[model samples]
Target: MKTESTDANTSDQGLITLAHGAGGRVMRQLIESICVEAFNNPALALLEDQARLDMAEIAAHGDRLAFTTDSYVVDPLEFPGGDIGTLAVNGTVNDLAVSGARPLYLSCALILEEGLEISRLRRIMASMSDAAGVAGVSIVTGDTKVVPRGKGDGMFINTSGIGVIPQGVELAASRCQPGDCVIVNGTLGDHGAAILQARGDLALEADLVSDCQPLHGLIARMLAVCPQVHALRDATRGGVAGVVYEFAEASGRAIRLFEDQLPVRPSVRGVCEILGLDALHFANEGKLVAVVPREAADSMVAVMREHPAGRDACIIGEVLDGPAGSVQISTLMGGVRLLDLPIGEQLPRIC
Candidate 1:
């Protein structure tokens, strides 16, 4: 039951507390100390309710635009390979890339529980600054809310992104055609496994780390080599299989994949085996499922592997004119299996 600052952290304001959201002294300190410092900008200087952006010109190019928003609520707030700060930045970037858009900017919203450690908050902010710097996207606007300690997680971040779709690149699952080769950007399940390992909630052990990273650069590089890329999707939640199933259903085609060609890191496989989770269905923060024309698959893959985040990229499967939206796996044991989506959360709180 921490109280909001009757006096600001500085002489100008008091320490922040839950009562800040009550529209009083506490809230002002939270805004001035945390919010104002982390997201200082001219557009946000006025502290208005709504944001007015000068992005209307990007749509006049006779190309469609893409808008997406997501919330990151992973437990522990920190993980082995990355913390939520960089994770939030890269996550939003990858979303725009997979949608065939060139990500330009992002808006961040943070929810802080009362009594949160100021040190932890500072570290998260620093990580976010570095990540945003690397991804080349600006955090133009943001909002902050404080809740009672038990009312919410220690910290929650929501990011909304906007990007301009390039002309002549219509990448959607419906555009997937038979004979299109399926390409994956890199090893799978690293992000989810890394979070779980760091938490010690799974009671299993392995040297797994999250693959969370910004993939927009890699996607841009690949597009420069070949824009005929039918579609691009980041393997986040629902993992590689989820993205493939989405394309199959959207295009009314069957996606056939081979186990041998699928990229799985040694650490990922070892962790999943101990935890009884399927690597295919686990999450990947820094990978993608790309659909390339059969003739151009090799070149695209080669280009992807040249990038650090795409070293293990592989061409794992192809689309076929079968019962649309079905994902079939050819196991290394010479048996075929259907990869139906999991009914419920097999690994809850896995990131």
Candidate 2:
């Protein structure tokens, strides 16, 4: 066991300094007081270089292990519904969940800027702990580094998650078929809209909040009812449109979404109209897009609606046998138009 360093100042009022990242007493004290205290668990308490998970325990849940990693750099750190910390935890969890895995453990690595407030770091870590608890995962190991003040943002988080995929379960974009139905769990682009408003650069205002949340529980329920789901993806960086496009390319099929069926919040729509940005091209955090056989579409939507995260679940489109790797939208004007991925960044630093 390591004892607390008597030479280091343990006050929470000061800003992060380069010394905090140096391999010294200050760094150890920071880890113990902030990260370990926020995410209290036996494995993390061990303070080892890596988490030693029990293989037997992990194998009992499933036949294979699923691992995923993601980095969060959303601007403003704190947004309407969640901060970068919460996004880091949930985003990685969703990556595993969409693969039909039960997320279990996560490792958090933080890059904090020198001169960053310790109080802010505390809040962020607390948020991460809460999100991990909600997702039923443990933060077992992590690393922290402090960068020069202007060289880094206030904070950046990178999370890697480990999960177990049960036997007899498989999902992939390549499995999609022409008769599959496309569904989204909720509205699109809320997170993008929320971040835009929070930035204050556009002088925009709305009641929008990021749809940031963990989806493993909802996905488990979805799989329980519709085991034959062809593909699953959470709408993130490039929103629902991005996910459908990937499915089209991978499956060698075309996907057509109905403009009227996209569940966009009024506030989000307003923001899009003002910026001339299509909500389809915006980003989302908590929403997922699923593909299921035509026969199971209604039942899948029904099961999804029973969960709070998916109350707006609805079929947005269907797979098509037309040109491969093409995505189209049936406009409300009774016309179909090709939807292509954006040329450049539609919105940067939008997790």
Candidate 3:
């Protein structure tokens, strides 16, 4: 076994090793040379144990702080439209965004497997930096650890984010009311379909790409026009169906969705048809579901359409008075079917 001092003196051989996580010179160098260089912000440069934030600056954005965290272990880290790095930043940003917050800062933690290429790590770090820039959030502090090659995958990322919810911006599933309009920003299931195809588990071909993007900006635009928006959720993991179910359960109201209004891309629809899947249940990283009073629905959608992310914005459903805590979908065949949450994840590690 190599002594700590000896390991600290050794240089990186273009691959990650256990020494990189030993909390010694090697670990410090890895963080300073790669992670710090990628995210060169003042707060992160301090190299403090915890990020020192300006409370006054935070207070200027809103009265309450909105915080969220998520982990990404998506198989085949790099997909068509994004990679695990992009997902790490955007995922946490969206978590705060859906709560009507202005996403601000993020903390990244990496678990790397030994023998991973240094070049790959650099590329992933750069991706994370770029994604933070796009989301207008700073990566303030982070930690890194290396595990044995077989003990971990290529890498896993965990991101925690903080934002501020402006005054009067109270959003929750309990606020959903009957007659409220349910709207989606864009096509659903693109991310899930893209990941499925990227995995190359089946001999399938489709021009699908992950819709993994930061939704905070688009959500801000929606809230600016319609502050009365009741509930908002990024349709991830369990997808739109999952979000609708949450709203129903929280508000004790029924949600009815119109199948025809759901905007699903042709490639995604094709993938679903070939695999016996429903686009409604597929995961999406960039899409969101919103519930707003009927009076504000049209204007809200109009504003949403003005943004790039919401170009395909449309109302897909409405809150109903019958059958509390139930979600039903009106299929194109003029038949209604209960849209229940999946007992098991259709696409594991999808986000």
Candidate 4:
């Protein structure tokens, strides 16, 4: 057995042994070198069991709090554009942001498998720290655990976030109304396609990277242009089609989507075509689906295109007056097709 003080066991070049999770010297070393050093915030610095925040500071933003939690178990751990760490941060942040909130803080929990490389842990931690900084949020608290080899993937991350929704902003699925324009903020399916390629499951390959990013800034920009936005959802696990179907069911209205207007990257489209999959059903990490008043549709798309994160934004659909709780797509081939909720999983563990 490797001793805790041994350089071979504690160094970054070393592998994470079960001893590293025992809540002793080795565990403390791992936490300090990777988690503490990387995240480096006053709240995290305290090393307390839980993070404490001033209620006054939180209450100043809004009367409501937006809280969300997500877990990332993407295969390959590291992918073309991001890793599980980046995914964990961006996923939680986007969830809060899409609900019309200003994201503020996060809690990170890591599950590491025994025999994993210490360097990999460091790299992921650095990625998480950088992602949190980019989103203007802090990793206020975190926990770590280790599982036996073969019992777990390299690493899994769970992040919980809290944000404040500014006054006068109401966004929800039930807010959808007839004539509301459905808009998508940029190309879809890059994240899912990228993950599939990363897993080496498909023989064909093209340049694809996960569209993982913080969407708070983009959401804020859209709200500034149209505060009356009915609903906003980050199309993640279920993708655009799932989101539209959800909107239809929640609002008890029909949704009509223009197939030609949906922005799809050529590479992603090719991959989906070859794999007999629909890009609309694949997962996305950075894209958003918005339902806004018809009057603000053109203005929303125009403003979205001006933002870096939304340069490819466009109107893809709209809500209808009747034939409630269903979605139909107007195909580019001039035929209308009904879109149903995905019956089973298309891609598992893509996120």
Candidate 5:
């Protein structure tokens, strides 16, 4: 039983140094005081190179497993509504949840830049712990590395998640039928807009905050009401617009979206307008875009609205049969136009 030395300093005033990643006393102190303390769990308590789980426990849940990984490099590390830590957990959890899985475990890896503050790292770890607890998932294994100053950003997180897929639930882009309805859980582009503001480059201020949150709970509720959902995706990097184009291309169908129905917050709209950006091309963290049979659309929206994370849920569009592999938007002026995928990076380093 290896125990951390009590003489080690765990004060907030401490700053991270390259030696902390040298896999010696300093590294042990950093892990014990920050990572282990925040993500306290039986599996992680063992301190093994990998987390071990009882096969019986895993088999009892379902017959299939869903695994996914995502990396976070949002430039500001910390944002208005969430930091990289919270985004790391939720992003991984949402990846599995959207595949109709119940997230079980997560593996977190951190890349720290030299000169980073220890207190900031602790705060990030705490946020990750809270997010994991909220989603009923455990952070079981992790690794840390430190890079030279200016080499790595302040911090970057890579999270991989394992989940159990529920029986009788199947989701895929190919399952989207021509008549399927398109639904979004909430407003679009909040995360992208918030990140831009966090950078302080725009010098624009609004009441906008990143819509970063865990969506598994909200997804669970929707599944309860409509188990036959055709497809599900959390609008992240490319926003709902990107998701629409991808699905259209994959399903060999066209997507028709009503611009008037998109749930963009007033503040988010202002940010996009001033910056000459399209809200659909921006990113989001907490929003989900789902496709369901036309018959179940209303019921799904109703159930989603009951959850706090989905109060703004609405059906924004529907799948179309012709004009395959294309996305079109209906303007409020009764005109229809192509909604092309953004050419280059609208916002860089956005998770």
Candidate 6:
């Protein structure tokens, strides 16, 4: 291991500032003194860059399984449609789903601040259990640690998930091509707006609830109809722009999106108009943008609309071959413009 260099005398500050990534002696002390003691497991004790997950338990005769991990620290710890507990489970499962896997089991890690209500923790745990049951996954193991009140946030959750990817189900980003159609499951900006609303970040106020829900069932239905999907990406962090731009860059193509085709709820548009945030750039937890071949576009949309998760689905754009890796939008008034990636944090602590 590369020994981190730093002078001693680090204090328990109130926030998890950039110091956590300083990678110096002070950082090691933080991991050892708190994180390590909380999650003192033999496998994790090895402490390598990547967690070496053994598959002997879930392995069958000749099966290859998938493994993924995610962390959750949404502000307020609770939100309109869900709290942090359901967030952790659904987030991890969605990661596995986009990877073309059926989720099976999970391991959880918790960092709790001192003075947190035990009753609140119980509620979160109960929510997690119910969500996991609904998703058909299990929480096999976990670890917990308590930081001094000022030194930690209320609660942070980390989950590592494992699943199985059956044969002949391939989904990748680099498969997009010119003339392919882009589709979205439902409305956007719900999760991001809800998070912002909960934090009181916007000047105007209205009831905004997150669109956070599971997508495995929807994804499976899409795969059933058009398993030849060029790509499938959940519009989570940076929303549809981030995922579509990524596909353009990865596939060496340009994206042309029609403004009217993109779905935005009236509630979200009203809030964004007052707050000065683009609903397109807002994050969505339960929605996805799928790139499908033109030949299957109409049929795919028909099938998607039949499913509850995709009833509001629409073809938002088409891939093009001009000026590679650029995203162009055809304005509602018959003009064209390039959409740029958002700079700086718009809403903080939003999943």
lDDT-sorted candidate list, best first:
2, 4, 3, 5, 1, 6
Question: Candidate 5: global Cα-lDDT?
Answer: 0.90
Across residues 219-297, which tens digit of lDDT does each residue of candidate 4 receive?
9999998999999999998899999988999999999999989899999999988988999999999999999999999
lDDT of 3 by residue, 1-351 (tens): 122222333333478889889898778878887888899999999889899999999999999999898999999989999999999999999999999999999999999998887777878889999999999999999999999989888899999999999999999999999999999999999999999999999787778899999898998888888889999999999999999999999999999999989899998898899989999999999999999999999999899999999999999999998699999999999999998777999999897
**Residue-level lDDT for 122 in candidate 2:** 82
Clashes of 6: 0
lDDT of 4 at 254: 93
Best by lDDT: 2
Question: For candidate 3, what is the TM-score?
Answer: 0.96
- Identify the superior model by TM-score, candidate 1 or candidate 3: 3
Off by over 4 Å in 3: 1-13
| Models, CA RMSD each | 3.6, 1.6, 3.3, 2.4, 1.4, 8.1
- Please list the C-alpha lDDT of all candidates, in the order they appear: 0.80, 0.92, 0.91, 0.91, 0.90, 0.78
**Tens-place lDDT digits, model 6, residues 270-346:** 88888788888898888889999999999899988998878999999999996889999999999999989888667
lDDT of 5 by residue, 1-351 (tens): 344434345567777788888898788888887898899999998889999987778778788999999999888989899999999999999999999899999999999998888889989999999999999999999999989999988899999999988788899987789999999998899999999999999878687799999999999888888888989999998888889888898999999999999888899899988978999989999999999999999989998998999999999999999698999999999999999887787999988
Q: Give the per-residue lDDT digits (tens) of candidate 2, residues 1-351.
A: 343423244455778899889978888888888889899999999989999999999999999999999999989999999999999999999999999999999999999899998878889999999999999999999999889989888988999999999998999999999989999999999999999999998877578899999999999999999899999999998889899999999999999999989999999999999989999989998999999999999999999999999999999999998699999999999999999888886999998
Higher lDDT: candidate 1 or 2? 2
In every candidate, how many clashes are there? Answer: 7, 0, 0, 0, 0, 0
If both were scored by TM-score, which would come out higher, candidate 1 or candidate 4? 4
Name the runs in model 5 displaced over 4 angstroms: 1-9
Query: Model 6 off-target regions past 4 Å?
Result: 1-63, 203-205
